[model samples]
Target: MPRVRALSGPKPRDAPEPSHPMPRHLRTLTALLRRAETVTLLAVLCVAGGLWAFAALAAEMLEGDLHVFDETLLMALRRAGDPARPIGGPHLEIVMRDITALGGITVLTLVTISAMVYLVLRRQRASALFLAVAVLGGQVLSRIAKAGFARPRPDLVPHGVDVTSASFPSGHSMMAAVTYLTLAVMLARQEPAWPIRAFFVVVAALLAISVGLSRVYLGVHWPSDVLAGWALGAAWALLVWLVARWMGRRGGIEPDRARPE
Candidate 1:
């Protein structure tokens, strides 16, 4: 009885190690990546919508359903007493001529060439190449659109400027949006401040819009034509921007923030 001892219970297995929480920085990065993906998806959807809208408009125009609307807008810009003259006086005509020139091949090419040179000198070769592709591709697309639709220029009023191409989409309007918007985005990337970026974008939009309006005011293009040009041009620019961003993130191109000094 003196040596009687109680048996000890069997020991329990050790608990599995607690899983470690993800580091805060890693979590933040993951969230940012997710947000970027969401933004890209939205951008793609918008591009599709813009394309669909252009197609629908083109179809309607081909069917002659848009003639009334197009004619009304075109005629509205002309003087009531004289359809041969635009609503504005001769002075205004001169101003519009100057504005329209901003979107012409000469001016657009000069701007694009200058931008490319600057980007190249800054060691942003990828961006420079992309810019060249975007502008040149836009030109090709504009030509194709004109050939495909082959809509004649409005004859309801005297043209403010000489034009010979099919007029479903205004070349000046489309190229203006492409050139100005592309330049704006490239410039915005160099700025860290949101306000500065917004300013650049607004200015670009204004320039594009004014060019489109000038085309209509000059009686060279129908309102629908200008609208179609704007929609398609904006979509193309946005598509290029998305591609550039995606490439940058994948290390195919340098990030804007990491530009060489």
Candidate 2:
């Protein structure tokens, strides 16, 4: 057979065994990262931050207008949370305000995060860290903002509940938004499908909005206060989500389960 060229000269070193194909999980993650969905998330967060900065600046510029509008809302909810005048019994309004305050949420968030850490220790350390950072940062920001505004609570309306914080923005509302929203995101990351993931996102949003509204309705917060708190809280939530995405990229937390093709 004309010497067959020595059977192709040492069999081409067995074709290097096809490089030992990566595991399915690794392959999938690599493919997901190649799509760069995390980059898009960071872009969205940037936009949100920019928008929040603009809103805060605008509110500062229109401090007089905002104060007027807030007084208007305060007038409407006179019976709900005016700590100055006892209306329909501060009892009911106090209960409602407590329902939306940070104390109960603090306990609830701690328990939830503790359980998640125990259950998902290997895959959720970074998520847990981001959660802690967001919560602490939000609390600090709220304190600073409240002190800077140093706006007195409305004495024109009945004060239905006791509050120690300044009245420019609702601290309880802000903290509830940040804490619950962050926990919701962490929970969403563990789910397998996108729809359920989206559902949780909506639920978190609704919870935050509802808490903000409760503050306004109870007359403990001005409408502007709640609005500012919502904007700031939403911005913080987006920032935390950005950090989580970075963690996912660095293989700190597990990849988000709902990656696209």
TM-score of each: 0.86, 0.71
Tens-digit lDDT track of model 2 for 205-224: 78778777767766677787
lDDT of 1 by residue, 1-261 (tens): 599788989987699878999998898879877977897899899789879888888989889899889888888888887899887789998999999999899999999999899888888888888889989999999999999989989888878788988998889999998888888777676666767877988998899999999999998899999999998988888888787787877887667562211
**Where does candidate 1 have its weakest 10-residue lDDT segment?**
252-261
lDDT score for residue 58 of model 1: 90
Q: In lDDT terms, how accurate is model 1?
A: 0.86
- Per candidate, the number of residue pairs that clash is 0, 8
Best by lDDT: 1
CA shift of 7, model 1, Å: 17
Identify the candidate with maximal TM-score.
Answer: 1
